[model samples]
Target: MTTPRRAPRRAPAALLGGATALALALAGCSTPSSGGSAAGDGTVTITVGDRPSADQAAARAIYDRRVQEFQKANPGIRIEPSETVWDVQTFQANVAGGTLPDVLKVPFTEIQALIARKQVADITDQLKEVGLADRLNPQTVKIVQGRDGRTYGVPVLPYAIGLFYNRALFEKAGLDPAKPPRTWAEVRAAAKAVAEKTGQAGYAQMATENTGGWMLTAQSYSMGGSIESEDGAKATFDDAAMRNALTLLKGMRWEDDSMGTNFLYNMNDIAKDFAAGKIGMFLSVPSAAYQAVVINFDMPKKDVGLTAVPTGPGNDNKVLSGGSVEIVNPKASEAEKSAALKWIAFFDLGKYINQEAAVADAKASAQDGGAVGIPRLSPISPEGFERYKEWIAEYVNVPLENFTGYTDNLATVQLKTEPVKSAQEVYAVLDTVLQKVLTDKGADVDALLREAVATVDTKLARAPR
Candidate 1:
């Protein structure tokens, strides 16, 4: 309900180092309950997490109002809002201690492992009963399924990596703002033009805080390479696609001199610079336009433009994707689980299917100085999404025409999830390789890939089987 400043844009959850201890702790307790208190008179009470903090008064007010409305509409269920949120460092402890709310949101990267550890509930039947199963995006929903093909969580806030450009820069460089680059070659030429004409960094790359690896992996995928094998037991990125990807970056940094002087960029630094008009183009989700350009840095909404990540020869137009999912307490009773599902449907997803909810949310966000109409991967079915968009059309504030390059190509670009095993570790390893390529003029791409293969193979060996 809030401006979506950061929840949907958070980096992947860090590696769960305490997973073994948490599993042991969970095993010791036969049944875990979210303390979803249920009364004998057929009334159920569920505790939900992710209530906005008090400092976010406007968003919090909307959330609290939704809670009250949900309770009043469904008198059979009472809602208790909790401010608990997912933090990699504290998540394991909360799960083991049974301190989590009945329902909470977590990143997609954590779903597979959570399902493996039996840390989240199987909500397949509840979803069907609540009529939410068919409403969801089938492709995105797969991320929350177990090997047995059962559901554990509901996908929300889905996003695919895309190229975000500064329209003002594009115009200043004598390029068409409506037509973004669709291939790597075009991107290179455009970056050079922006640099030569505007005296700004034509392009930038994220080079630290594990984002270096993240963006590099996305680039490699776009060039038709993968980071791990099918079962995620081996490193598989030592190939020509990855090599060429790095080679391009190396050339951009040293030969073209278009990437600017600063080589170290995490999510925040990159967003900040991009908003300040120091950079021209970069890879990120469309949410960055709202979170970075408008809300954080006060960039004019009309100046931001978004398009699909450019494809390479063998890419088939696939782009990396990730987002948030709502998981329920594995220890909850059936009644509690049902109540939790209903709450999720009403509070998290009401906007997608209900016109009133959609307009109310968008109006509030816009009025509160939050960005409206930023493009995102639809979590619901296509038909549902189209209707939702129509409902909010009047309140839409961002420049939709500037994003036609992405929205028009959305149907063609495929969405790929991140690696399934030791993802953070793989990213950490790749960060060094990307940094080397960008910062060291003579960095050897082949040698870097070979060394990474050896290091990542070792990481895969130590990962839990």
Candidate 2:
């Protein structure tokens, strides 16, 4: 069965466009008057974003229940739920308008840029005092932190790109679906088998939009390539790791004849094809694998399988990680900030530690027919995350065993964030390079790397610090 696709997520907003947004935020924001004491007086009122819209009946019901429960548990803290959520286009405008929720959930990609732009608050001390400092998933923490070691946001759900494989194709190829490839050599063999047996694209890639560069970076990391300098000042991908990764792709496409003829693919398009069984394996997150491919694409539940991003000769074994994180408004008062942290601890962080809350959350997901039991990179210790998973195990709807190859190794692999300076711009440039390499048999990898690096370096030089 096939289903129509849901609208793709809004693209990340251009870096601070429109003079009015800058002018409004730069002019200063309206501050919320502090009514309650900073020390747990029931008087502090805080606004939180990401309230489920009324259209999302099941989710909204759970959200309302949680809000009421939260307000009751912490009487001294009054909670205000905002329908205002993150959108790339209007986020900065909201920031500029000073109309942002005291606590807003934003993408991991925005954390560094927001910090660099002075759009979010520095809550290092507050997080430390609240004991979240020690417990935060160290891997996810790296993405939100500044060079000074201050964190701008608290990661709510972190995920690493994994190989989303079609189990039916694997079975048809006489390969083990649960045991996904660990290295490039293994991937090559599996791709060959899947293509030869199923007459499908054994391994496809996201080669359009900025996603092309995004996946390329991930593949490059598996081969130990760096895209930029530590200070986010220069290009660093013109090396062996970069070439080796490209060479491997070249072999898969031209030599082994594994990848299919179609080269144009964005994240959404590829998910649809993967779900339709036209493709065997691709890079994606659990949400994409479960929601986009399985739920929306109507793929067989058991046919969808996953494993960690494959590793190569690159920088040990590491995966590129990303997810949503909550940040506080810079204009919020000290009491407001404290109250905001309390709300975050209660909402985002609380679910993992509180048994009732965990079970309720999972049950809500199950009731909503949302995919439950999708393994992911935790924003806390892997062990703690596993325990939380067990707490809600009864509600698990997806096949957990299929994801073991990815989840079991989360702690052992190094989690790498996107390029620090002009990350989107860098990806855009690399997108062209990737297209060139895949489309032209005679394309020179070294020349493409040097040209792309030069372009990225120039953009970095011109970027605002």
Best by lDDT: 1
Which residue pairs show collisions in model 2?
42-76, 137-379, 223-314, 224-314, 224-315
lDDT of 2 by residue, 1-465 (tens): 001112332111111111112222222222233553334333677788888799976666656666665655555566788898877557778987988889988776667878888889888887875567777888788888898888888998777878889999999999988788988888889999999999999998888777888888888888888788866889898988788888888888989889988888987789889999989889877665578887777888889888888888954656887777899988877767776776677667775755655666676657656677777777786667778888889988899878888877878778777787677889899889888888999999999998998899999999766
Write down the TM-score of every candidate. 0.86, 0.83
lDDT of each: 0.79, 0.76
The residue-by-residue lDDT of candidate 1 on 1-465, one tens digit each, is 112324342211110111212222222211122334766655787889999899987667757766766665666777789999987557678888988788999887777878988989999998987778999988788889999999999988788888999999999999998888999889899999999999999999887877888888898889888888866789999987788789988988898988998898877788888989999999976786457766777778788888889888573446888878999999888778878887777766777756656666676666666666788888888778888899888878788888888888665467777777777889999999998888788899999999999999999888764
- TM-score of candidate 2 to 2 decimals: 0.83
Instruction: Assess candidate 1 and give its lDDT.
Output: 0.79
For candidate 1, give the lDDT of residue 334.
79
Clashing pairs in 1: none
